[model samples]
Target: MRDAEISSWRQWVTGLMVAGLVIGTAGGPLVGQETDDAEEGPQQVIIERTPVQLRDPKTYSVSLSLEPIREIDLVAVADGVTGAVQVQLGGAASRQAEAVRLDSAERQLELERAKALFRVAQAEQRATSGGDANAVEAAEGRLEAARAELRLAEHRLDATVVRFPFDGKVMGVHVVPGQFVRAGQPLVTLADTSKMRVAIPVDRTAVNEGDTVDIKIETDTVQAKVETIVPLKAEFEPLRELFVSVATAVLVLENGDGKLKAGQTVFADMIPRQPVMEVPTSTLANMEEGGRKVQVIRDGFVRDIPVKLLGQVGEEHVFVSGRFSAADELVLSSSEVLLDGARAVPAGAEIPTEEDEGAGPAGRRRGSRF
Candidate 1:
């Protein structure tokens, strides 16, 4: 029963195929009368005008961003017991406050001794000071020393407290309260996620200095200009010349409402010198037997145009053909049963809508495997 239905469909298309030939020859000078009918007519899929692309669209890329660029490390300046950690909202103490607090007790005694010596030097008589200039020297020296000692004592006392250097969240807490810490020990690690960067592995063969590139992280798309192409050679992959393949480029990222994250995997939309076309694989269509073809609808006729397949492009076949234009009309097959040069009517043609696709901007139809 299915076979009979198939035969009947074929018979109907055969009749339509003959009608299409007659319709095509109506305006032009008739030549089919003399031409051999044995030659298969141009398979009817759809007739479309190839778009005249000025600058063909292209997509190429390097690595988006791999890691954040601004990362900082916090370390303890001096060693001591952890004390008051700027527990107030206002001015916080310094990082080495713990060390200062530990030595504050001894500093107070030294400050007192310095003050007494300063007083003794100031009491020297002018006559004695003039006759013995050494007295003046001793007084000034002692006074300076006393002032320094006082400052030291104050600093030591202040060391017991820790304060924030800048407004930021605590990334980590290494030593807790009452925990003994040593000098130069790591306290917390901080990373500025305000803006991220992508390290792109550039191909010296494909990229040059100062070439702009695009990176797409999920739905977010951003542009990155050429900062610097770092020329590096590895022991595993040595450079054949002074500069080998694979350069590192710092790609500045646009936060775009902070949608992008550090260490997130993203694809780079690297623009190449060569223009390229981005089309869906479904847009690539193969005819009954005349290789691959795409249906182009123009002037109310769907004509099958030949397309040269150019391998796979993200699971879609990229076709190279002179018939395809950026603004040409792409006719999706009518119920997947359309034939070459099939007579078709555009839907909603005379509706007088605000927007019009006309003969261009219609997407393509990928052919099914016969």
Candidate 2:
């Protein structure tokens, strides 16, 4: 019985194989032809493209604090008690204006005595004009000594008043009326606010002196010019490690209206020094080895073009430089995998409107057949 069962199973399998061969001979060619047709047909990808545009270099923003163009601490030149305070804290001090006056009664008396002694010396020198040569020489020496003493007295008297060296704002006052202050002690802190200074960190290759930039403070925006550039020191080695050519840019902004103040937060927009090409940020792709690339339609086929990313213009756009030209059409979006040299059809070739450009990543999607 087992032999019979095995023999029957063999016969059934042989019959099924013969039947399958017959069907394949009649219908398999149709299925194979359909697959061959599909393989030979041109791939249909719903790709979105835009013409590459030449745009101004991207602007990089950096936060900074405003500082006075010039600041100094006015110190006491002589030991004296503050007799009067002419300028109050936060008040404007004019050039050559007296800011403080020390008690000068003693200084006044010393000045008077020096004047009297000078007059006496002059009279004695005149008297000795016809005397012996030795007596005349001694009188002349005495007159010279008196003149020197008078000049010293005058200088000491002048030291009693603290005068503003330049037009500025008094930021601090350390001495009040009747307060005794020693020589070299700080009396007032003054800052020249007619122009504001700010130090901005940026890529040295992208920024240069004399370049004008926009600075934002609170809600207001003002223009500032790059005054100088300073290389980073060893202390900024970490920053240098991150950005090899990192440096500080000194910028100056006019504040004649006194609207800008020191220590206020400011945002400086640093524009790139070189011109660059602009494209949508979503179009950038990463290579397996390294670096970035963008797809462009060339000869009706997808071509990969390597680009150097200079900076970002906005959330959706980027500045780049490479071998591509403004006439090239950049692949903004594609529904299928874009392989190098793969034939593709751009379904939307018209330039995207501003509203469409801002429609987020979803707007890049479209129905496609591959």
The prediction achieving the highest lDDT against the true structure is 2
Task: Pull out the clashing pairs in model 2.
Answer: none
Residue-pair clashes per prediction, in order, are 33, 0
* lDDT scores in order: 0.47, 0.70
Q: Write the per-residue lDDT of candidate 1 for residues 48-107, one digit (tens) a residue.
A: 223323234222222334455465555555676664343322122343322112323454
Off by over 4 Å in 1: 1-66, 85-131, 155-169, 205-211, 233-244, 267-370
lDDT of 2: 0.70
Model 1 scores a C-alpha lDDT of 0.47
Q: Give per-residue CA lDDT, model 2, range 103-194, as digits (tens).
A: 99999999999999999999999999999999999999999999999999999999998899999999999888999999999999999999
